[model samples]
Target: MLKSSLNKGLIEAGCDEAGRGCLAGSVYAAAVILPEDYRNDDLNDSKQLTPHRRYELRKIIERDAVAWAVGVVTHEEIDKINILNASILAMHRALDGLKVRPEAIIVDGNRFKPYNFIPYTTVVKGDGKFMSIAAASILAKTYRDDYMDRLAEEYPQYDWISNKGYPTKKHRQAIAEHGITPYHRKTFRLL
Candidate 1:
């Protein structure tokens, strides 16, 4: 079972990002500040849940959480600053959007820059272990998925609807055949 949070009484926000590995499109991150007493057995890593379940849980998380916000860093920015920095910046941006500031932050991965001088902990696989991080994962994944779905309409040849801009065999083939889109991260290995 995922724990509600790392800190018991403090207002904690969980941070997570999606699309850091994608070859195209923007990276998205979410900051979720759930109530300290919240609990949901179904919540887990966004990756562990199906797309349908993630979307469903998104509604619940948004409705029940004390506050939640999403942030994005575009492919162009990713190319300029690199994925790691962009991912961290996206998390900071998410925190910027939160209506309720957090007293602490728990991040899903092991790397994060300090945000607003709040105390923080970086868990290697926090999404699978903490409810707020899992919720943030769901929001980030679903939001980025929706953005990619729209991009798929613009560049159907890349099959982003299927691969979501990951470096899938088909996606790489599309890059070989048609070249990169504005959404492609030029710094990434496209082929």
Candidate 2:
């Protein structure tokens, strides 16, 4: 079972991002603030869950969370600032949209730029250890996957509907055959 919150008696938001390693589409981030007593045995890191499970958990998180929001940074932005900074910026944007201010933040990864002086703790694989971070991971992964599915309609040659813009062998092969699309990150090595 995952812990409810990193600190007691304080509103805490868990932050996580998805698609940072994808060769196409935007990166997405989510900030989720769950009630201190929130519990779900099925909740875990987004990558650990199947698509159906993640979607189901996303609905539960959205309905039960104190506040939850998703933020996105386009491929263009990623090329400009680099994926690391873009991922942090996306998290900040998600935090900006929260209805309730968080007293502290627990992030799934080791790196994060400070958000308006809010104290944050970075945990390697924190999503699997904290309920709130797991919830955020579900939101970010589902949202980014949805975006890529939509983009796949316009560029089916890349097979984004199946690969979801990850740098899969077939995705790279498509890039070689079809060349880059407007959605492909220019800074990323496409070959």
Candidate 3:
């Protein structure tokens, strides 16, 4: 049972990013402000849920949340600033898109750069512990996966539709065989 919010009195947004560890494609982040009463038994960390479940929850979150938006940092940006900074930048971009301002932000990971004078708390694995964070995780992961699936059509050699840009054995093998595509993060260990 994920907690609805970290602070009861304030409007809080949960933040999380996906594809930070991937070898290719952009990192995606989501900031979600769920209603205080929102609850769903199936909602959890995106990683723990199947693709079907994540997609299902994405629909639910989008429909039910007070405000939800996604942000994306491209592979070129990741190569320029490095993954950690890119991930944070993505989160900031997500927060920038929020229609409603949040009094507080609770992030999934331990490190997050502050946004817009808003107070933020970084909780290790907050996505699994907080409902809003879990909703954000689902949004980020599903959106990134959808992006990678489209990229896979253009660059079938990487098999991104299946691996979703993660450095799987087959993905590495494809990099070795066909060389890196424009989508591959050059700073990453592609081989």
Candidate 4:
């Protein structure tokens, strides 16, 4: 079971990112502000769920949340700003897309910069513990997966459709054999 709120009083949004460790494609993040009284036991860390379940939850999160938005930083931007900063910036951009302003934020990881004047808490595995964070994780992951699938069509040799741009042995092998695509993160060690 996941808790509904970090602080019962404040309007809170949970933030998370995906594809930070990928060798190719963009980094994506999501900010999700669920209803204060929301409850859904199936909601957990996105990484814990299968693709079918994640997509199912994505629809639920989108439908039930007070506000939810995804942000993406392209591979080029990741190379320019570095993955850490790009991940945080992607979260900020997601927050920017939210129609309902959050009074506070709870991030899924230990790294974050201040978002405007909104106070934030950094949980080591917030996605597994908090509903909003779990929702954010689902959105970020599924959206990024969708994007990777599209990119896979453009660069089928990278096998992104299967690996979703993660640095699997086959993905690295493809990079070594076929050379780099525009979506490859040059800053990352592809080999």
Candidate 5:
């Protein structure tokens, strides 16, 4: 079962990003604030769940979250700032869209560039440990996957539908065959 919040004493938004390690497409992030007592045994790390389960959990999170938002850093921006900074920027953008300003933030990774004066804690693999983070992970993953699937329609050579912009063998082969697209991260080494 997933714990509802990292700190029950304060309003907190859980933050996480998806597609940070991808060779193409944008990095997506999500911030989700759940009630103090929310629980779901089906909740886990988004990567650990199937596409069907992630979609189901995403709907639940969207319906039940006190406030939630998603952000994206485009491929050009990712290449300009590097994936790490782009990930952090995406998180900041997500937080900017929250309906309720949180007292604190619980970030899924071990590093964050602090959002304004609001306090934050970075827990490695937090999605497995906290419900809010898990919810954020599901949102980010599903949203990013959906975006990539749409992009796949325009660039079928990348096979984004299957790889989801990850560095897969077939994706690399496609890069070698067709060359990079406008969506591919320029700074990333395709080989």
Candidate 6:
């Protein structure tokens, strides 16, 4: 079971990003501040859940959370700022939309550029350990996946609906066959 919060007293927001490792598309991030009493048996790391389950949980989290927001850093921005900075920037943007400001932020990775004067704690694999983080992960992944799926309609060559911009075998083959699209990150080498 994922813990509800890291610190009981602080109004904490859990932060996570998706598509950071993808070869194309933007990196998406979400900051979720769930109620302390929130609980769901299916709640876990977004990666562990199926697409259907993630979507179900995403709706629940959006409806039940105290505050939540998703943000994206475009492929062009990711190329210019680098994935790490772009990911953190996306997280900052998500936090910016929160109706309830967090007292402290708990990010799901080992590195984060601080948001404003608010202090933050970075925990590796935090999504599996904290409910709010897990919720954030689901929101980020589903939203980004949905975006890629829509893009797939416009650029069927990339097959983003299947690979979701990841450097999968078919995606790399598509890159070799058709060349990169404007959405593809030119700096990223697809191996």
Considering every candidate listed, which one attains the maximal lDDT? 1
What are the per-residue Cα lDDT tens digits for candidate 6 across 1-191? 88988888889999999999999999999999998767887889999999999999999999999999999999999999899999999999999989999999999989998788998999999999999999999999999999999899999987899889998899999988988888998788965
Q: Candidate 2 lDDT (Cα, whole model)?
A: 0.94
- TM-score of every candidate relative to the true structure: 0.99, 0.99, 0.99, 0.99, 0.98, 0.98
Tell me the tens digit of each residue's lDDT in model 2 across 1-191: 99999888899999999999999989999999999888888889998999999999899999999999999999999999999999999999999999999999999989998889989999999999999999999999999999999999999989999999999999999999999999999999888
**Model 1 residue 38 CA deviation in Å:** 0.6
Error of 6 at 147 (Å): 0.4
Q: Candidate 6, which ten residues in sequence have the lowest lDDT sum?
A: 34-43
Off by over 4 Å in 3: none
Question: On residues 1-191, what C-alpha lDDT tens digit does candidate 5 reach at each position?
Answer: 87888788799999999999999999999999997787778889999999999999899899989999999999999988999999999999999999999999999988899788999999999999998999999999999999999999999988899999999999999999999988999999887
Q: Write model 4 residue lDDT over 51-163, tens digit each, in one string.
A: 99999999999999999999999999999999999999999999999999999999998999999999999999999999999999999999999999999999988889999
| lDDT of prediction 4 | 0.95
Please give, for residues 14-117, the per-residue lDDT of candidate 3 as tens digits.
Answer: 99999999999999999999998678888899999999999988999999999999999999999999999999999999999999999999999899987999
lDDT of 6 at 43: 85
Off by over 4 Å in 1: none
lDDT, model 1, position 123: 98
lDDT of 3 at 178: 95
**How many backbone overlaps does candidate 3 show?**
0
> Against the true structure, candidate 6 has what lDDT?
0.93
